[model samples]
Target: MRPREASALDALPALPRDDDGPVFAEPWQASAFAMTLALSERGVFSWAEWVDTFSGELKRAAEAGTPDDGSRYYHHWLAALERLIAEKGLADPAILVDARDAWDRAAKATPHGKPIGLSPDDLARIRDAG
Candidate 1:
């Protein structure tokens, strides 16, 4: 994935939650969703094309007896993203690997304990500085 895509995915948990719950209840789903949006926004594919591809993938998965649970759905999304990236020559696999590693490190460094030490904005600035 591109760095912006990864960052977008990483930001999902911090976004205000929708009534259905969090917009992304799972990490992989967030990643997949961000990737789809990023690719579409970048003009690599149209939104209609993305919907069609997702529908096709869902149908194939159903035929294989795997219903469209979130994880499987995201897996399909990731596969589609990978295919598009490859077809468009957007970035090589090595770049994606590096991006993933950077994202993972950032995710890990995020505070998980009780809020302390600073206001949210201040903490964010501190993290950004680091």
Candidate 2:
């Protein structure tokens, strides 16, 4: 990883990191972490901007009476990322919502341990809705 990406990892202090790497409770959590670094490195947003957004997210959850436990930290991270992506106009928010719903449907339909795959029809539905 580049120096900037390495610094991005510092933004995630809640996650347990060792010489190997940061540990995640789930695969999707790691995927979200990777996406944040990739987008930051691509100039989608500055690391400082991410810190502000993520900080606000954490504060919001606390104000809403959510526990400070680390279990939901990644959910807030994802919310911050989605907010930033929309705020930056990098992607259409409606398209993102549509894609998320499609994925929800696909995941719901898939059996446990099976890789969730979106059918062509699902893409067509998402595109049409978007």
Candidate 3:
């Protein structure tokens, strides 16, 4: 992590973490955190904006009766990232949906215990959409 970005992340209040820093129950949770950090480093949005949007997502989810046991934390993280990127006109919600579908197809096509790789058709659909 860049020094500046690391410090900015350190400043976030109420982050779910231990002494080792952010605790993720799944690999995708780690990925979501890293992706959000990368986007923020690239100036997609400020940390302040991220905090606000993420808090809103958590708040809304709580109000909607989602679990508070941290199982759904990264779900809200991904949702917030998508909303922020779309709000900034940096990404299209539909294209994101298409990419997600493509990923699902790729995962379904992969054999058990093998790395998931996108098929040519999946790649084509993604590139075409972009």
Give the candidates in order of TM-score, highest first.
3, 2, 1
For candidate 2, write residues 11-104 as lDDT tens digits: 7647443465458978889889999999999998999999999999999999999876676889999999988988998778778777888899
Query: Can you give the lDDT of residue 34 in candidate 3?
Result: 99
Candidate 1: pairs in clash: none
Give the candidates in order of lDDT, highest first.
2, 3, 1
Q: Please write out the lDDT profile of model 3 over residues 21-106, one tens digit for every residue.
A: 55787798899999999999998899999999999999999899886666687999999988898899986778788778878887
Relative to the unseen true structure, what is the C-alpha lDDT of residue 47 in candidate 2, on a scale of 0 to 100?
Answer: 96
Stretches off by above 4 angstroms in model 1 are 1-19, 69-71, 93-130
> What TM-score fits each model?
0.50, 0.71, 0.75
114: Cα error in model 1, Å: 16
List model 1 lDDT by residue over 1-130, tens digit each.
5565455667654433246666666877897798789879988889988887777777777798885545465777777777667767877766666556655565666688733243455445445543
Question: Candidate 3 — what's its lDDT?
Answer: 0.85
Return the top candidate by lDDT.
Answer: 2
- Decoy 1 TM-score against native: 0.50
Candidate 2 regions exceeding 4 Å error are 1-22, 108-113, 124-130
Best candidate per TM-score, number?
3
Location of the lowest summed lDDT over 10 successive residues in candidate 2: 13-22
